[model samples]
Target chain A: MTRAKKTWPALVALVALVLAACGGNGATETPETPETQAPETTAEPFVFGMILVGPQDDRGWSQAHFEGGKYVEEKMGAQMIVIDKVNPADRPDTSVEQVVDQMVEQGAQLIFATSDDMKDGILAAAKAYPDVPMIWSSGDSAWDIGKAYAGLPNLGNIMGQMEYGKMMAGCAAALKTETGSIGYLGPLINDETRRLTNSAYLGARYCYENYRGLNPDDLTFSVNWIGFWFNIPGVTLDPTQVTNDFFDGGADVVISGIDTTEALVRAGQRSAAGEKVWAVPYDYRGACAEAPEVCLGVPYFNWGPSYLEVARSVADGTFEATFQWVGPDWSDINNPDTSAIGFEFGEGLGDARADLEDFIAGLASGEIDLWVGPLNYQDGTPFLAAGEKATDLQIWYMPQLLEGMIGASSAE
Target chain B: MKRALRAVPAVWSVLAALVVSVGLLALAGAPPFEALVLVLDGAVGDGGRMADTLMSWVPLTLASAGLVVTFVAGLWNIGVEGQVIAGAIGATWAARTIPGDGLVVIPAALAVGVVAGAVWALAAGVLKTRGGVNEIFGGLGLGFVAQSVATYLIIGPWKRAGIASTSGTEPFREEVWLPTVGGTRLSPVAVLLAVAVIFLVWALLRGTRFGLRLKAVGANPASARLLGVPTEATVLRAFALGGGLAGLAGAVLATGIQHKLVPAIAGGRGFLAILVVLLAAYRIVWVAPIALFFAILSVGSAQLQLRLDLDSSIGGVLQGILVLFVILIGGWQALYRRGEP
Candidate 1:
């Protein structure tokens, strides 16, 4: 009996561990039949995986990607397996390769690793699964002509030219700011982030001079970067607090360049308290809904059209590794089906809305050239000689911030 | 006979945990059986999934091995997490600064990691003996300090070139990584090290004079001192031993797993090791298998999220309840024994 008693507990513990499935009890109504592929018909559905860097409902960057995934499902009749909040602060040690392995095993025909932070993991996974087609958003790995090309035959890249959108955001801020100052809530310091911040400054400078009838040099544009894409409580400086600081420091308008909508949300809260301030949220078209009254507008990426093409190509067995930097459709920037980038005016655009539209029209018709010369780097080095237009390389690999911007050009 | 019978309460606790957990799952609205199948399939259903499980097992077993020494000394060295971080920092420093490639880098960097971890743990040991600070609080405070130091290095000095972000340092040079088996991420060296630590821990705690002294000091510090056992020294040594092991785990995380020094480098594996040690009833014999079990649950729970749309945290809740039930039943057994006496 004594020996039996000793053996019993060990056996029981093992059995309990191997058998206690945690809980799929309440998940009966769950729509997560991975093998069934959501449609039990004879025809097979194209299954793709989307690994997101933040919450799907974050109302910003990841949400835009999530909507893009949904668009693929709607248009191509594909099934998507999405996992979000793939960051250390959220679930530490869950590697992108591990997630990719699971997705591929479950028959993901293509994988979309969406987030600049996912660059390393996606590349590693691409090498591991050489047969699976992969799209890495906001990555330069597939740009054979660029410096960071990985030459992975299975990997391609897709990124919207959000520079134009940032310019629009800057233009609105320039037209609306009564204080002659615009604060940009930036996300990290890299070539990509630097270029976006510089783009916003250029738009602000152009509008503050020509459209608003003020000296572009007189507009004070300060860029403050919080180390990562989104706030991670202890690890990152709070975006809300940073937005408040911008308002408190006499900047009447703050434009966000991060993955979340803290700027517009904070501005709306402050506006509710009678503060005359506004914010421009980035990444998602519907971001203005958070604080429509205080939101000047939002500069967003529409990933749908690009994602749809990838899905179709993969399904039709005509996919090849390529790098695409999609831009807004000049015909109608708000056309959901065609435009890769957009800027939707908010209720807070108020009387300056028409001016912002005219500026947009000018950009569309090639009448306004923001990247044209006489521009200087932040450190006073000449970026463009007189009347010299920036080449694709100069714009894409912006090593420093522009002149007249108050921020660190590089990490050092 | 009595020793054999002592295992009865553990068995009943497992049974009770199973029942209560199944009930909880039912209340959660998930069909318990399907969820179990989901996690089981996710865990070791194939060679690849099994490899992932073993990868998680490496750091876990290492941390648990270290904790065994501390537990034997009756020390709650909660700063094991920080020691892990210190190890990672030390290894990262070697990866970046150590010049010449292949021949000497891996073992040399790991040796540095072990030293860094040992030194970090000794600080808590010194505090407990010299400053009248409890090991728990001192360890926790130091852990926070270590975390802050790591964050500073990542975002400030060791950050990626031209990138001011806390994502992590640049990936280690190709030579810095611990070699893996042919195609998978599994490192045979990491697994062997963990196995060696288990044997080392078993031998050191049960077969040596120092082990006897540690037990004496743990049982009664004054009594051990009266018996001329050098209680404080033994305690400090116990802490160093544990912290050294934890530092090795950190090295594995850096060189073997992450290949970079991330801010959350320890990945809370230190805390999970605490659970493994506890569930093992502080017995060294159970530590390895129990650590593997927990690793399986963790790796498999991802399947729960993917297949059933259930939160991965469901696995965490089950582990917590299992531990709780074991403690509760053991308490009841103790009370029953008291009544019998």
Candidate 2:
């Protein structure tokens, strides 16, 4: 009787173990049907992966890319695997390192690392697993050679020229600055922020020196580095505080170099409260709607054409690893098939919109260069000569705060 | 044999919960199996990932081991996270200003981290034991305050001169780097040092007269006080020691993994350490494996994110659920229920 009782419990325990194992196994099998069915209906086997810096719903930086990824998916009928909010501080390549591995293992042919910080990891991954094609956004020179180089035939970088939009934004800010004193909320004092600030300053300086006959020093400028890309509580880069400081220092026109729509919203609030602050936003796209009344204009990067062209090239196998630029002629307002730099001039433009449009036309036609001489950084250092346009390298790595900005040059 | 058989249900439940939680995450648009696979690969998959996992474990284990001493003494040093940040900041400042040989630099950096961590913890200890403030609130408030100080240092006068974006201490030289093991980033010295810390903690809690008195104070402070034990002082000392260990972990993180101090150097590990303590039931020896388990979960979350396209937050959710289930299922001393009682 005792033996029988022990046998019964043992048999029950074995059954229970089998059930638990089956329950776990059931989850793994869930995707099998869909994964098989997906290939049958689509008739295409191409799987592309994207690693994002933030959540898709962020409605800003990462959101723009997410929308682009979706666009590619729709146009190419491709399969996509997206990883979002990949914290850079967590590991070397963020979450892309593992995501790419999985995508490759699952037979994904192409992988896209959507942020500049992802460049190193993507390159490392590309070299380690050469069969996968890796696309990196915002990397300056992967096509060129360096010790950190991961020489994979399938890897390349894609970027847009938003500087033209920045210049237009500066034009709006310069024209509207009642104090002739505008503040810029710059995230990092990198080459990108430098040129964007410089372009804004160049346009502002052009208006102030030519139109208003004001001395450069009289147009005070302060630039504050938030020391990071986003507001991490207990860390640096609180845009709210920085914007408040700019307003406090008599900056009536505030331009943002940071990628978020936060500064524009804050400017709207400040304006509503009778502060009369105007904001010029960058990485444009939907930024005009962020605070249309207070938002003067937004310098947007049009990624549509570039994304379309890249997708077709990958399909055709004609894609080469080159540092390609999508600018001006390829991107302007009319071209539906190429990337371009342009901004949405807001309702507050009043009568200036027509004139601004004309100026943009002239800029597009190369009649004017914003950096034409007598330009100086905030510290009175000359950056451009009369009748000279800044080179790609100059624009790429522009250092120093431009004159008349309200903020520090750098953080630790 | 029967006693061992009884433990199977508890172990099986934990496994079941982990599997279910991971499946839920996969359903939320992640590849569940791949994520779990990658997590395994990252945590113990190979030498490289294992080293990385171990690298993360050093500070965690060190903090966990230290917490055991204070936990046994019945003082909850919830402020270990702040202490860790404080230690990192202190060590960073010392490493920056003090010039020395590589050997001296490591010790100096460590000392700076330890001292800073201890001092931050002691403040809470003093308030709790003497000022009669609850240790929980005292530690919580001070943690917030310490974070602010770290912010001021990074953003204000101490901000690195030219580098823009990212508030961080200046990077230390390669010479100042802690020694590593066998071509991996796992700092051998840190491991050795951690092992020593574990032993010291085990000895202090289980061996010495001080350990006995501390347990007495923890068990019944009033009774221990009546027995002429300086219960308050002992508790304060434990608090200070615990804080120092957390701080040391922070310092190690700054020096070892990151090489420069960023505000996020602690990375919520301090809070996780408390979970480790509870899961181990404050047992000195149980902390290691529990910490490793949590580390695997973390590493695994990253894997799931990559392989399955799941969000990294999913790992945290799964861990939270598992811990919650364990607590609920454990059900307050049910394991030790007696027929007489």
DockQ of 2: 0.18
Candidate models: Cα lDDT each: 0.84, 0.69
lDDT digits (tens) for residues A53-138 of candidate 2:
65544545676676676667666676666766665343322335555765676667777777754554576577767666677877
Tell me the interface RMSD of model 2, in angstroms: 12.0
Kindly provide the TM-score of model 2 when superposed on the true structure, using C-alpha atoms: 0.78
Chain B TM-scores across candidates:
0.94, 0.91
Q: True-contact fraction for model 1?
A: 0.31
Where in model 1 is the C-alpha error above 4 Å? A1-41, B1-30, B100-103, B311-341
Q: Which tens-of-lDDT digit does each residue in B87-184 have in candidate 2? A: 88878877777798669888899899999999999999999878999887888788888777776776665655544545465567767778777765
